[model samples]
Target: MQPINLAAKLALIHEHWMPKVVAEMNDYQFKLVKLRGEFVWHSHADTDETFIVVQGRLRIELRDGAIELGPGEMTVIPKGVEHKPCAPDEAQVMLIEPRGVLNTGDQGGARSAPNDVWI
Candidate 1:
């Protein structure tokens, strides 16, 4: 396979909260998603989720507190922890998680994007 450019892939995305598959390693997938405003509170029961900020900022609000992530920052939210993601403005992010993990976790609804979509 050839190398993938993050900037070029990001430019092709136009929807917020929908992750587009970029690459894969073993059982994990690398996905890119845009964020703005608030996301639903949810948790993965089986595996942890990693969020890497590519541009702008992201805030993950937990039941007890919140974690603010800026560009170039990353965080891993352990499995089964309830949290909500929010962004003050448009933000680009990369997510690393097991293949088939849902974007909305157990709280599937209108916000849940289709899995395994590629750019």
Candidate 2:
């Protein structure tokens, strides 16, 4: 297998809301994405999701409250917790989740993206 340069891998994705898989180890996948505006309100009934900000800022809006994450910060949205992710401006993020997780969570819609794409 060719060595993967994470920086180069991340540079390949230019669209917002589309997460591209960079690497996978065990049952987890590492993803890189550029995000802006608001994402769907949803929840993962069986799995938790982790978000790590690589650049700019992000907000995870939950039913009870909201959490803001800046560069170098991270948060884990627990299983079954309803939440919506939003960013006023473009933000670069890395996500670590179970291999088959749908980015849209349980509330599937137009923004739901196919999983298992390897870069």
Candidate 3:
């Protein structure tokens, strides 16, 4: 297979909070989202969510505390654990999760991103 250029794929995205699928392995999907401001608090009852920061900074907030990440860093929020992702500015993030999991999880609403979408 040919290589996938993250920056090039990311450039094609124009909207924030929208994750475009780039690759998949078995039942897992790899996605890219441009995060700005703060996301709603939510939790996936069936699966965990992984956030890998490729550029800029990211802060994942939980009820007790928050975990901050930057370029080349990542963190996993366990299933059923409520969390909110925030970015003071735009941040490029890679998400790894099951194929059908919703971005907004149990709190799906206007902020929900479509599932199984590709770049």
Candidate 4:
């Protein structure tokens, strides 16, 4: 199989908060998303969501506190826990979750991006 170039894949993404699928492993999917400003407070009821920062800074705001990540850093938000993701400027990020996981989690709204979109 050919290697997936992250920078090239990410370069094709111009919209913020839209997660585009890059690859899949079993029932899981790897997604690339650009983050800026704030995201709605949400959580997944049935699965955890993992965020891996590829460029810039990302802040995962939890009820208790917040976790900041930079390039090559990552964190997993446990299932059913409310959290908001934010960034002061544009941040390149990757999300790993179940194949059908919603970008906005359980709070479907105007910000929800369609699931399983590939770049």
Candidate 5:
């Protein structure tokens, strides 16, 4: 195994909502994504999703409330809970979830990204 540089990998990403896999453990993956604006409302039916803000700010809008996160902060959205992610400006984030878990979750359309793209 080799060490993965977060910033170095992030520099390779140029699009929002598209997550690039950097590493994997067991059946889970560590992904990096750049986010801005609002994402569609959706939920994973079987697994929880973790969001860690690497830079800038982000907001996870839930049906009942919203959670705001900044650099070095993170939140876990439980399975089956509908939520949308938003970033007023550009935000660099990391996601930890099981392999094959869709970035768009239950909601799929033009905004859905490829399931597992490695950098």
Candidate 6:
């Protein structure tokens, strides 16, 4: 395989909220996303979702509370937990989730992007 340059890879992305696949292993997929605004409330019933911020900041809002994550910070949202992700400005992030995971979880909304297709 060719060498993977994360810096160069991250430079190719120009959109927001859409995640681009960077690598995959076994049943999991690793993705990079640049985000802004608010995402629809959703949940994954079968797999946990991990988010790692590479730059800027993000917030995950749940029914009970919310958590703010900054650059170099990471958090895992357990399966079946309803949550919404938001960013005041813009944030670069990495995500780890099971293959075939739908970004909107079971409850799809207007914000749900097409799944499985790598950007």
* Candidate No. with top lDDT: 1
3 or 4, greater by lDDT? 4
List of clashing residue pairs for candidate 5 = none
Please give, for residues 4-34, the per-residue lDDT of candidate 5 as tens digits: 9898999999999999999999999999999
Question: Stretches of candidate 1 above 4 Å error?
Answer: none
Between 2 and 3, whose TM-score is larger? Answer: 3
1 or 6, which is superior by lDDT? Answer: 1
Using alpha carbons, what is the TM-score of model 5?
A: 0.98
lDDT of 3 by residue, 1-119 (tens): 56889999999889999999999889999999999999999999999899999899999999999999999999999999999999999999999999998999999999998877788
- List the global CA lDDT of all models: 0.96, 0.90, 0.94, 0.96, 0.95, 0.86
How many pairs collide in each candidate, listed in order? Answer: 0, 0, 0, 0, 0, 0
Single out the weakest 10-residue window by summed lDDT for candidate 6: 1-10
- Candidate 1 residue-wise lDDT at 67: 95
| lDDT tens digits, residue span 1-119, model 1 | 89998889999999999999999999999999999999999999999999999999999999999999999999999999999999989989999999999999999999999999999
| After superposition, candidate 2 runs with Cα above 4 Å error | 1-5
List the lowest-lDDT window of 10 residues for candidate 4. Answer: 1-10
Per-residue lDDT tens digits for candidate 2, residues 1-119, read 56876668778887888888887889999999889999999999999999999888999999999999999999999999999999999889999999999999889999998788766
Clashing pairs in 4: none
What's the CA error at residue 68 for candidate 2, in Å? 0.4
Q: Write the per-residue lDDT of candidate 6 for residues 4-110, one digit (tens) a residue.
A: 66557778888887778888888898888888999989999999999998889999999999989998899999999999999989988888998888788988877
| TM-score, one value per model | 0.98, 0.93, 0.97, 0.98, 0.98, 0.92
RMSD, one per candidate, in order: 0.6, 1.5, 0.7, 0.6, 0.6, 1.4
- TM-score-superior candidate, 4 or 6: 4
Model 5, CA-based lDDT: 0.95
